[model samples]
Structure formats: structure tokens, C-alpha cells
Target: MGHRSVADLMTPTAITVRRATTFKEVARLLKEFDITAVPVIDEAGHPVGVVSEADLLRPRPTGGAATAEQLMTSPAVTARLEWSVVRAARVMQRHGVKRLPVVDTDGRVAGVLSRSDLIQLFLRPDHAIREEILEDVLTRTLTLAPSAITVDVEDGLVTLSGTVPRPELLPVVKRLCHGVDGVVTVDSRLTCDSADRT
Candidate 1:
């Protein structure tokens, strides 16, 4: 299966805040929006940082007087719309963040992506995985007829069996199938024509 992009799962029209937004308002927004954090945008609507619940709850010198600009984690860790969900997960893990501000080409806040969103899309059904391997891996990638190979998927595991035109390409097919999302394992049961088996 093709990699799902962040844009496919992100929540567009995310609630955002300005740098001058007060601490109390930030807290209120988090509660009202049911979000853990919000991007602090500049006048041009570009995110400069994010203010999460932890940042707001920690003791501060300014206390009640503090604003989002003073408390936010600066130079925000962001994700692009085109990034694969796998790559986005790595970024979130690297930063130890529960959510990321999705940014457009101009660096403006396009949406918000949460851990749940990635997890929901990561686990695909066995039938969908089978179709991709048969349609993409076999027909398009290997340039073989659909009838040339038989693909079976069960519980995220794929089994491939048939007489391949090029025995040398079996390894390539296995690798591609393994790369597909939700493919837990691959079982190769392929052989080649006797004359080509040298």
C-alpha cells in the first residue's frame, strides 16, 4: 500500500493562538477545543512555537501575568502536509510530543496531527493489503500480469506463490510487500521456469 500522507489524517482548521494570548485564555482554549496544545502564530499566521498543558501548569515567575509568547516552546517542532504518517510518528517520538502543528508550504498552521490520527491509519485491513500487493507490487512494480502471481493476505501476513517470469525479481517483490503498511510478515512461495532457473 502507498504511504498515507499527514494531510489525509490531520485535523484541518485547527484552533490557534497569538503570542500575546494570556495564560488564562490559553488554558480556556485548551479546554474548549479539547486539545492538549495550540500553535502560537505570528501576525502572518506562521507558527513560532506551541504551548502545551505542561508548559502552562509549570510554576512561572510571571504566573498569572504570563503570555503564550513567554511560556511556549519556541521554534516549534512541525510536520509538513506531504510527510508520510510513518515519518510523522518518528518526528513526534523524537520530540516527545503528543501532537504536532501541521504546516503548509508557507510555514503557516494548516492543521493539527495527533498520535491517535497516525495510529488509526497505520493499521490497515488484510484485504486492502492484499489488493495493493497484487495490483501494485505484482502488476505495476514487477510488470507482471495479475494472473502471473497469486497473493493471499491473512492477519496482516502475505503469502506469494506462482511461477515468476524472472526468478531474480522475487526478492524485489518480497521487499515491496513487506514495506506496505499493515503487512506483519511475508511468506515467499515463488518459483521460476525450469529453463530460467540456472
Candidate 2:
């Protein structure tokens, strides 16, 4: 399958905070929305910075009333609507960030993308579970030659059918498929040439 764009997966309705907002207010927003972070927007409604839970947890100096401007991280790492989710994941990992702002062509914030959002995209029960199961199988068991096999999942049951050069791969594939989350049973019919069989 082709890569999905960040905009396709991003939550367009995002909560935002101003630079002058108080830490107390920021904390309230997070708690009220059950969110981990919020975009810091300027007067023009452009994202200029970001504030996360970790930033708010940092100890403050005595008698100091920290503003969002003082606690926010600037020069934000943002994603374009056209960017692939893979690229967004790389950017988040590179910056050690949990979320990224999705920006429009004009550099205005359009949405938010978070680690939890990405995780839920694949793991959500509302989506076809097969895709998630197949992905898990490919990543965990067939790391070296994952493309050699095909996986089909339906209602928690997995049916793996494909050909691998090594006969020993069949049982390994079965074990891997069985190990995936939401996989209840594995029906593996993988085959290998006689010469490759052990």
C-alpha cells in the first residue's frame, strides 16, 4: 500500500495556547482535554512554539510566574499536509518529540499529530485489524525477507499464504503471526522448494 499523508491522519481540531498564557492555564487545558501538548500561537494565529507536559513539569524558580513564552520551545518542528506519515515519524523521533503540528502551505497550523494518534491509527479496532496484524508479522518475524509472504486476517483469525526460499521460515512465520495483537489463530500454508526444505 502507498504511504498515507499526515493530513489524512492528523486531528484538525487542535487546542492552542498563547505565549502569554500562564502555566496554570496551560495545565488546565491539558487536564481538561486530556491532551499531552498544545500549540503556542502568535497574535496572527500562526504557530510560533509548543508546550508539552514535560515542559510544564520542569521546576520553577522561587517567586517566578512562568508564562507560556518562558516555558515554550520555539522554532517548532512542523509537518506539511502533504508529508508522509513515515516522514513525520522520522521528524518526531529525530527531535524526541511526542507530537507535531501540521501546517498549511501558507505556514498556518492546520492540525496536530501525536505519537498516540499514530499508534491509534493502526491499532484502533475500528479499522481493519488485518492490516495491523500483517504489519506486526512483517516487522517482527520476517525482518530480513518480509516481502516474501502475504498475510490475510479476518475477525482475529490470520491466514498466511506465500512462498519463501527457506522451508524453516514456514513455522517461524506461523509463530510470528500468532504473536501479533488481536490474532486469535493462524492458518499458515507457506511453502518452499524441496531443495530449500530442512
Which candidate leads in lDDT?
Answer: 1
Q: Point out the worst 10-residue segment of candidate 1 by lDDT.
A: 189-198
> How many clashes in candidate 1?
0
| TM-scores, one per candidate | 0.80, 0.63
Among residues 3 or more apart in sequence or in different chains, the pairs in candidate 1 whose N, CA or C atoms overlap within 3 Å are: none
Model 1 C-alpha lDDT per residue in residues 1-198, reported as the tens digit of each score: 556788989999558999999999999999998888899999999999999999999999999889999989998899999998889999999999888999999989999999998777647898899888988888888788879788998888899888777768888888888878877789999887567546
| Models, CA RMSD each | 3.0, 8.1
The TM-score between candidate 2 and the true structure equals 0.63
